[model samples]
Target: MLSSLIFLLGLPLALVAEPPTCTPLIPVTFDNATIPRLLGHWIYITGASKYGPHLAELKELKHAVFDLFPGSHEDELNVTEIMRMNETCVTRNTSKIQVFWHNSTLVHADDQVTSMAELIQSDKDLLILKHFNNNFPGLSLSARTPNVSKERLEEFKTHLHCLGFTEDEVFFTSEKDACPLPGEKTGEGSTEPQPE
Candidate 1:
């Protein structure tokens, strides 16, 4: 019981991470060269939005994980997401088509361009996307996996602040409550199945 209490006490400290510092974010174009680096599992670290409704929705979301699989077509990608919201696990699959024009990332769902974003190049493991979309207007920082560095998280928050979002508007997600993919067994770690 003492160990468990100690673990709980440390959890909040772990989340605070390092202080925010400007991480020189360089916008990178979405292309074949950058595609491979992005094709993998990404854990939603945290996001800050000026949109009120977006924050309300994010408050219900405890955790979310996304798997980006290269689609059969060159311009498309198969996206698998599992998120735990309101104490329920929700899963979604979609084919997203991305097109870049002059450094802007245009994202399409169901064959329609729904939102556009800014893709800043980080290390192979870190992905920083600055979105000004109508639906979820925010700067979101995601990682290739759950073990994200505190420095990276702080850097992302700095960028979010630079984008005009306050610290209170940020939504932080936890990996301890990860949702499972369809057909995945309970008590199993995150997995990726082969494309059919």
Candidate 2:
């Protein structure tokens, strides 16, 4: 009878889901990310995330490009993201990002929700960003150029492993044609043909 009772009590414990694990390295913000230097274009090289809006779907993403511009407010930036879907369709999104420097780190916010990312390392050519939320840990590598060199890619992979991510969880992206210039009609919602 005691054995049966213990088994019954263990059933609920087995059903309870365990919390997700995260890397120990905290996100570090760069103090030198000036507005002018951050502006212009950047291409996505690779990224890994366990949870987010489209974490799984992003694995299939072919290409992504970002264009940063000055915002109306001095502390804000206008960000445009062009993402290629399945090598056929491209999607464009725009958001206003508010940034603040605090505790020697940079915090980014959109619509009042804040996300912190550490600038693990960066230079004139490449930028490494690492973010760890309770259940949403992510790492991304970007470059000024569309195509990054193999050596650079290998360095990024090393950083990924250092952040507790496995090779299978990470995916790389390529650069296609540059995103259309601002306000030239993206046909965002319609079935119109996208630019090649």
Candidate 3:
């Protein structure tokens, strides 16, 4: 009876002495991102998916644009995604974005849907978004302008490699007229698909 009591008294201390294990692919976020800086039109440059089931369909998306605006709440933002589907159809999807700190080092933006991207890297000219959940793990690159410098592209590739992606896995979208011209209507049936 005395030995049993001693073991019980030491159990709590043993459990408290154990250290937590950190995963290699822990999510990261940028804390300096603000609404004004993130607002504006951005062009989709390239993307890499590690294990997405819809990767093939994503590859068929030849062009995309992300237009961000301030939301009704201070911590929210409205994001409009315009994507060219199958080289012909243009689809516009809008979602509300709520930016909050997942932790001290990670910032997460969720659209309250299947789209949740972590702000891994952001700069004046480039932004890198990472999506990893039960559905899939992917990385997307966007730029302020359609024409990204070669240096930046190389840097992006390096970042992908760090994230366990090879050159063959990375797919880059075409930059030719990727976005609609000013004043052009992007509604359904506004334009017909053209053959490649």
Model 3 spans with C-alpha error above 4 angstroms: 1-33, 102-113, 177-182, 185-196
Worst 10 residues of 3 by lDDT: 104-113
lDDT of 1 by residue, 1-196 (tens): 9999999999999779754556566788656687777788899888776556556657887888888888877666778777887667766676474756556574746432354567788888887776666665677778887888887777777787766678778888987777666776767554433332
How much lDDT does each candidate structure score?
0.72, 0.65, 0.66
lDDT, candidate 3, 1-196, per-residue tens:
9999999999999899764332243344435544566788888889988655437746677877878888887677776676666556454444666776554222333333355567654457776777765657678889998888887787677677777777788888886636464467666544543322
Model 1 TM-score, 2 decimals: 0.73
**Per-model TM values vs. the true structure:** 0.73, 0.66, 0.68
Pairs of residues at least 3 apart in sequence or in different chains that clash in candidate 1: none
**lDDT per residue, candidate 2, 1-196, as tens digits?**
9999999999888778443343354444535555566788888888897766446656667777777788887677787666666645554444665656564334555442455666664566666766656657777888898777887777667667766778888988755433444456655542322543
Q: What is the C-alpha RMSD of each candidate to the true structure, in Å?
A: 10.7, 10.3, 13.0
Worst 10 residues of 2 by lDDT: 187-196
Candidates ranked, most accurate by lDDT first: 1, 3, 2
The candidate, 1 or 2, that scores higher on lDDT is: 1
Top candidate on lDDT is 1
